[model samples]
Target: MNEHVPDPAAKLEERAKRKAAKREVKKTEIAASTLDALKQLGYANTTLRDIAAQSGMSLGSLTYYFTDKVELITYCVRLYKAEFIDRIEKSVTSAEGRDAVIDAFADELTRSMTEDLPTHRLWYDIRSQAMFDPAFRPVVEEIEGKLLETLTRVVQAAGQQDTSAVPLGYAMIDGVFRFLLQSRDRHARDNDELMAIFTAILRRIF
Candidate 1:
């Protein structure tokens, strides 16, 4: 007896799915490389060739996946925001109490300032560019709104009665970030000092 053969139409569909999966994987790989390239080279200096080289894909292959640098950057920004929001939610949910909320906030800030500096710098680079570039505005607006919403949720969970605390909290944090980035004399602040300042801001806001 002959074994049953798979249907041709079903096989075609499976092949299409595999192709789509591979394309998606390639897209993500390209985006990841683009992010690293952007971090190392800055937005203006980063090129498609750099991204392609970093991704281990040829320029033609990268272009086939992403039409141009703008498209690739937009895709990377969206991916970054999605992952960032997920992380914030997970971190906030895992910790308990207001003190824990403060701890979580400080921990995230520390990581952003130190371990995640490149990503944060890339974020600001995009943010500054978004002010003048129409292509980046939508994503920047969406990311800012989503981030504020996450902060608001965390504040509420931390027993903060004030609804406006999120904005104030972020403003204070942003001020600190700017200070650290701009000030030449602002070097070598210990974790204790940083956490103290963060806790003080939380107290004022809450």
Candidate 2:
């Protein structure tokens, strides 16, 4: 029997991989805490120290993972919005028919608005910041592009051959959601109204 020998390079590579994985886990935890803070305070008011306090981690530890508030916010928002997009995509794709698709899409929007209001508010706050600060525009545009692509798929599923109205439909949906976010009442009545308008818009596009 020959004795087995561990290669130094392989051992070093394995250690590096473990370190990276641990780093990612820590970053994710920090991002979740930052997201909570951002949701409550919005982008304008949130700071790195606030994130550290929220996360219960020392400021030095937090700064080691993320350089500043912007980097932290970028990571949090990207992680969240990617998950958000995946949810809407699943809802739209799983529906059985055109009307079902429309209803699913509209219901998901209503659910997000009512249940995840803080997250959406934080999203809108960051988006508004993009208007004034060029640094945030790239992320905003990337998110918007994904949104429009999903809307286009919805329109196509509704039997619309001409996809020219996708942008208009997206605009209408966004406008309605933003407007509803302002209302104090998040009752069923609000949901019904939004569903009606959203369904009507989809029907008109098709």
The weakest ten consecutive residues by lDDT in model 2 span 182-191
Q: Per-residue CA lDDT of candidate 1, range 1-206, in tens?
A: 99999999999999999999999987888788888889889988988999999888899988999999888988998888788778767777888889888788766665556655667677788889998999889988888888888888888878877877677777776777666654524676666776676677766665
Candidate 1 local accuracy as lDDT? 0.79
Any runs in candidate 1 off by more than 4 Å, and if so which? 1-18, 182-186
TM-score of each: 0.83, 0.88
Candidate 2 collision pairs: none
Assess the local accuracy of residue 186 in candidate 1 as a C-alpha lDDT between 0 and 100: 60
Location of the lowest summed lDDT over 10 successive residues in candidate 1: 177-186
For model 2, the stretches where C-alpha displacement exceeds 4 angstroms are: 1-8, 185-189
* Steric clash count of candidate 2: 0
